[model samples]
Target chain A: MTTSTRVSARRLTKRFGDFTAVDGIDFEVRAGEVFGFLGPNGAGKSSTMRMVGATSDRSGGELSVLGLDPSHHGTQIRSRLGVVPQEDNLDLELSVSDNLYVYGRYFGLPRRQLRGRIAELLEFAQLSERAADKVDNLSGGMKRRLTIARGLINEPELVLLDEPTTGLDPQARHLLWDRLYSLKQDGVTLVLTTHYMDEAEQLCDRLVVMDKGRIIAAGSPRELVDRYVTKEVVELRFPAGQARRAAPRTDGLARRVEVIADRLLLYTDDGDATAEHVASSTLQPVSTLVRRASLEDVFLSLTGRQLDD
Target chain B: MLPTPFRPLSYFWVSFRRTWMSTLSASFFTPLLYLASLGVGLGSLVGHGQRLASLGGEDYLSFVAPALFAGTAMQVAIGQATYEVWGACNPWSGAYRSMQASPISTGQIMAGHMAWIAARALLACALYLAVSAAFGAVKSPEAVAGLAVGPLTGLAFAAPLAAYSVRARHDQPFSLVFRLLMLPLFLFSGTFFPVSQLPVGLRYLAYALPLWHAVELSRSLYAGTFEPLAGSGHVVYLAAVAGAGLLVARRSYEARLSR
Candidate 1:
């Protein structure tokens, strides 16, 4: 009920016929923070985002966005909340500036104000030079940036981004992350969904891992990783078929040993000791690596499957 | 400031600004070409036949021009509504999906789409009327009323086609609608010949169509031969068809976009 809580959902549920897309989930996003929903495909992340965006109707439970119920106040809530869908829906026939202009008008913003706002947004998205260019002519990264810029046209207090940088290359993804960081600095509350573990670690201040329409874990990225996984991970990839056989030789040397495909991952506080211990054992591995544990490791530990799979 | 339902007009307005030159040329020349080829050229052959009396005792050129005006309105309106409405919901464009993210409701988006189609129909019909007038087809000042009749006929088709377009998963059905339904109505619905010339059952079928009512209403207006009862009947029929189609289209848009 407080003003600082931008979104609050208590046991929110969404069902499509016989299947439940978001099953009795609970989460809250505070103002001026980047919140994330991290899950693999079919994890119901986008479905939950749509419910919070006030576009899809919830079949059960209570939901409040910006202190308004979406069922009753969808138009009002949406007026103040910007949304960037998973797909870029820019008007490809219109100029970059006109796409922003037309979307601004949908909020009933005056034409005179929108003209200046469009210029500022285009500059913010780093697309000033392409103002008159058709959206069809822009590269994949440029189009994604333009979609983000268009969402900001209403000066919304809260923005919901669903998989913002799914298809972009590494360089473009970094540029987008910088823009998102700037938005956070401007005191805008952001709720985004991404299956990318690095993106969740780098951008999200707090996040929840969803799987099969339910939130299995929730916390800051570091907290989730620290609580669920060890401080360091030792990955041992044996020659093709020997990984499963070598798993027993590394028992009790670490907190946990997960045999994934051709690699045996040892979770331990001291990855170097674990790697050295494995080297001294009877097992002869093809490759060994020691690295800091990440959200991907945490997800794998929780779900028993890779995040990207 | 525009109302909530009309806010989407800004999108169409910007689009029209870019393509209006080509649209205008098409609108101006399409009627001109039809009138020149069918009305003037074909009229010369039909004028010497006994079919002249059945065309309400008017010249063949004048008789066919008014029907073409109403027919062109139907074509323009259907053309505007089909691909644009389909593309709005399709993945490539997703224009409706984008608008659904804003404050605009699905009903408002449908209203804006229908309004834009009506506007285009009005513009195209007005041009068709101008071409008919230039060829000495218009009989009286009352013929100006055909302008309203033209767009109404267009809406009669556009609204229902838009309803179908919103839910269409592919473009195959649209081609069927055009080839199977639209072409038959355009050719046989009393545009070029009198409905009385057809066999009894086929004549009744033509009379049941929206285009036939439009052609009849337009010819009456252009010839200054408006009948009190029949004129009211045609207007009511066309209005009802348009109003019913709009209702269905609004619901279809809501079902598709709000999901």
Candidate 2:
């Protein structure tokens, strides 16, 4: 086995007794790519990440990280692969930097080399000031950055993050995104799982939207939106049920119009033109806005929900 | 074989350093209390006139010190193997969650934990013996010759228990086994009053526990009753427990850490 390929899986399946967590799924992630698994809770995203991280056994199928089979080369694979699980698993008793140093020593890294790496990683994660502080004292965001710094102690070729920004504040999420984007530029392959549409769209170059342990769709963010939603969407609102009464304005203006709750979605190649057509028609609109379709629209079209819970 | 060329010695040192403070407290405090309270307080109640079956009569403290050493060893070793091991491996504890993602193998973790416990057991047993010596509890100086055997018995018992700890999702299984299986073994393994004082039906458990042979061989050494030819059986039993415990702990570690 070689330290390459980043990630590879074939028919990878995981089951806990009778329940199937990650069904037979196959994929490959090359070096220097940001790949994501999008799915809801218990949809097997974390379970799949566990198997790939070499901490959980797969009931069936072939899997490898860094061109090495996890079952046989677990220590090697783990040494080269950084993993951040759904929870912040930092060592609470130790200083934030000691957590990184102690973990680095486990990989047989000497103190001389480890000290410099620790400094670099701490700075990279923006945790330089918290180096001497105990892990328990840090806020949720600082602890997560510490976990990320620990994962990179070995200078791993690939990093796996399961819901990296699940509970962080908006500012924290943006900071994590900035750090991850730099990692991408540094050529570190990242495999993350998140049900958040915006996080996936922002981080992943390509992603597979998973449901019930299966990938329903796979493509880049723009590609998925284009395939599943129109170029432009119009949101129409009424004070009452007048939107339903003015249905004539929607006819022949677009390919499809779906009504959910109190808003009507107008799907068309040109949203401004559709707005002009509606203004000229018998329909007197209350408000009008046109914007490019997004991953959220794709998810809404596929799953029929504004956002996953 | 380890794929990452894992340094077992390094793992051992780090684990030892991390746990040294706690080990010292348990080793010093637990043994000191039992020896002082039981050997001094309780031994006064049992006196030298007390007869303890085939091993023959002796001072109560001298008679019970070796058995106490063995019993205390089991308690500490098994304690380290179970709760501490469980805490490290459980995802909720986040110890293994952090370590397993590094170069350390599950086996190394299991070994590092048990090895530290074993060393601590030996240290505690030694500390207990030194206190017993100062108290004039020893009938023969040859008893010091067998201080090496005390931790071996613990290692034998702790290994399997450590193995079990790696799989326990909670504390219930160990509680049942300790209360039902281990407690009886401790009481009737010729350690306390006598195995013969127990009901005939319960005598079989004393024979089954590793502690029975441990207590017997220990009393022989402390009382200067060594039999060059006949003592092999007791030695073998302790060896078997040590060997079996180590094997199971190692394998269970592999099961837990290796995907």
Candidate 3:
């Protein structure tokens, strides 16, 4: 991950009349870095991406992409930036290659240049064989690859992907990740939003966890885990929110207790020892297991363990 | 050189291409059936007034021909401003969202859709007018001008509806459109009978409708009867209505797409 800045966002805000979707968020992405926005549903990740992508307007604060103001030079900015919307918005009526072609045309790419680049991007995304196939005829993975290809048509300096793999299966998501990785290796800067912690860890160079229009945490995958959670965690299920009620059970067994939706995670150096302690406690959890702490834990710790309304 | 000025034209082409075939197939048959069956079959059953007003100035088909042409223009406008609007603006799979991400501005998108409305309305008006002419409804050459202005009328009527379409938060907007624009225009636009012949209370409502102006302009062109002689106001009213619609549509596009 090259650490030269490519995307600079300062105090960006999006207000729809009275409701604020993104409340003054600031972040910077360097060229060749796979920066990510991690948050759950309604977390303002998409709104932030829209603002940074140069499509939607920022209600307040300064925002810039590729050294241009989004408000004044949106068209020029869009000509250089690529955007993959949250949904797989491939033109169903058009073929896979045509989707990329039409998108390229929109950016005012020369036909000759776009044609050759489409051939290369098709091969890069591993969909050259499906070039003639209609978008609806392709698999979920194929559609995503096509979207990525469409984004790359402008040979963009920064590509904004809003929840790129939100609905993809494991295989599809991995294939997409591989394509993204290939793009990164080529020195293309990518900004993506995803709820999946694994996705962020796998693709993002550094990331931020946003919740309800605010960035609660920001760091690299390892940096965040190291900063917020222990190396390992022992999970104890005590039926529904009961694991949460038995919060004091982790006092002697491990260090800090994180009560998530389904289980209580006990942060400890010795996961097996923590599990053994859970078995001995008067508070009988329904189940007990040991595993490594992930970004999911970091997210909970940073964004807060409380449920949002 | 700035490539081409087809950004608006291409946008219209894309929208028009989606349903143009179906619209063409339907419109082609609508006028033929209405003119052939009604002009011959229904004309024999109706009285002197029907025969005179419709086809022959003596045929009911001829008399109602101009009205149907205007109504069809309104229908086309309504269709574009409603179902197509929903398809284009609905959050589920809005094309505008995708287009907004590109270099295409919100104003360009609105221009594209409105242009498609006018283009499709004109095509339908041409076919309907041709059938009316073939059936001996139009006595003068002026009726061809009806086809020319029919789409303009549609553009005027559909623009406000398109504005509303952009602002529509739900399917309920279609209902409001029907009650506010479509029904009121259809019932009072001098589509069936002359607005002057209607009750004074309802006549003013007809005068306010974009479709009424379209129907009057179309009928005048068809029968060479450009009377009531307020020629400048008729043209001004149509242009003003179109201008208002454009202003609202541009605002709506900015509201929906820029958000």
Candidate 4:
């Protein structure tokens, strides 16, 4: 493993009896980068993250975290790694600050130093005012922030977050994204798993699109969009049920044509050229929208299925 | 001496501080009330001479104090070990999973919980013993020797219960332990009376339990007599149960938490 590689897995596999959760998959996470596992609910993203966190042992494959084999140096590897699970497991009985203090103590950090560290983490999570409140009393966003703060109490080298914003409002999601971005700025390597294309597009520098139990595609959001989809897409709406009938008229106008629901999508190298042809053609449409291709289109083009189901 | 690297006791200390009031009254006061109502109030009706002879020339309060200490140890240990393991392992709390993600090993987490239980059991026993003394139930200076029985009795239940608790998918399994196993052991384990007075078959059944061994050992200590072979037998029995329980618990915690 290279010094820059924080996590490296070769043909990593996990099986529960006969049902495989994670098939043979190869991936690597480097230092100071936001790496994401973008997949649906059952795509085995969390299973992979658990193995990398050194909490779950892989059934087969060579896996290393921070240049140490997890099977042999699990505790040593975990000492340098931090994990925020999909669920909030903060001590519901303790105050917000106590949660950080107790979690820091689990890392064997001295009590004298943890006081200042907890204060700093509380500030970073924007939860300084609610430090003394019970964890249960806080809102969903505050609890999530506190959980992340607890994960950072030991000042880890790499942090693994599993769906950090799964059930949060838009404002809460943005606030959490800000905190994570600041952590990335401080050079904390992040490995997160989420099914949200927008989140992956917004946060990840590199990501892998997984389906079933395998990674079907891996690249930056821009790279995957460029590799899998055309440069632009023209959305044509032909009032009510005429979209399916209008799709045939645009067969030769665009590189690829697809009719989904009430709209027909025309994928082309140049959307303006495609739109000009549609305007002058025999086809009659109500409205048209032209936009750049995105990861959502990439997922559909590669899998023939939508990412959000 | 310096604390161990993880200092698992701190987990229990912090948790205890938050609920010490309830823990104190519930675990610490139950034994005192039992001594007052059963050992004193009921002892008044049994009459000193007849009861003394029947209890082997000892007052009802003195004879039952050590036995109750052993029983209380079993109660307190089981109470803490079972629920805490369940709570920590449950998906909602996932405390053990959180700890497993840290530098602490599964063994350390299990050990830390055990250490915390030991501290609570010891404190409860010490308080019970002190209250026993104030009740004028002190028969011999060796009465303090009953102190060891508390933790041993508690651990005898705690370790194996912790093992069971980790594997428990829900709270339903614990009720079988409470209704079927622990209650029978508490009622028939010689805590309230001498097992020698029990029926022949029931006496043999009582002899097979760890609490019975703990009670006899504590009684012997309070009575200021030394039966080396018998003492060794009781000690060996409790030590074996505790050892086996610890082994099973370690394996269970490892299997459950390290997955």
Tens-place lDDT per residue, model 2, A35-153, is: 99987787788888988998887899999777778888877788788888889876676677777877787777888998999999989888898898878799888888888878888
Off by over 4 Å in 1: B49-51
Candidate 2 docking classification: acceptable
**Which candidate comes out best when scored by TM-score?**
1
When candidate 3 is compared with the true two-chain complex, its DockQ is: 0.34
lDDT of 2 at B103: 71
lDDT tens digits by residue: candidate 3, B1-259: 1232235444446445666788788898887887676656765566733545433353565666777788888888888787677667664344676667777777877877787788888988898877788878886787876776767778887888888877776777687777876887776676655576788988987787677777767766777777656645676788898889999999988977787
Which candidate model has the greater lDDT, 1 or 3?
1
- Against the native complex, each candidate's DockQ, computed on alpha carbons, is 0.77, 0.37, 0.34, 0.49
Query: For candidate 4, lDDT tens digit of each residue in B1-259?
Result: 2133455555666777899999888766787799899889887776652447778777787778788888778888887887787997776565777787888888888888887777778889888888887887767788677787777777888998999898888887787888898899988988888888899999999999898998888888877774889998998898899889999999999788766
Candidate 3 lDDT tens digits, A1-309? 124777777778898788888988989888788999988888899999888888788889888688789899888888788888888766676667776766666667766887899999999889999898877788777787887787788788889998888778999988888888988898889999988888998999999888889888898999999998999998888777676668864677777887777688788888987787777778787778888888888877776653232
Rank ordering of all candidates by DockQ, starting from the highest:
1, 4, 2, 3
**Candidate order (TM-score):** 1, 4, 3, 2
Off by over 4 Å in 4: A236-250, A258-264, A272-288, B1-5, B48-51
lDDT of model 3 at position A264 = 80
Q: Per-chain TM-score of chain B, candidate 1?
A: 0.96
Model 1, range B1-259, lDDT digits (tens) per residue?
6678888888888889999999999999988898899887888888653346778988888888888888888888888788888987876666788889999998889989888988899999888888889998899898898888877888899999999899988887787888888899999998988888899999999988999999999999999999989999999999999999999999898788777
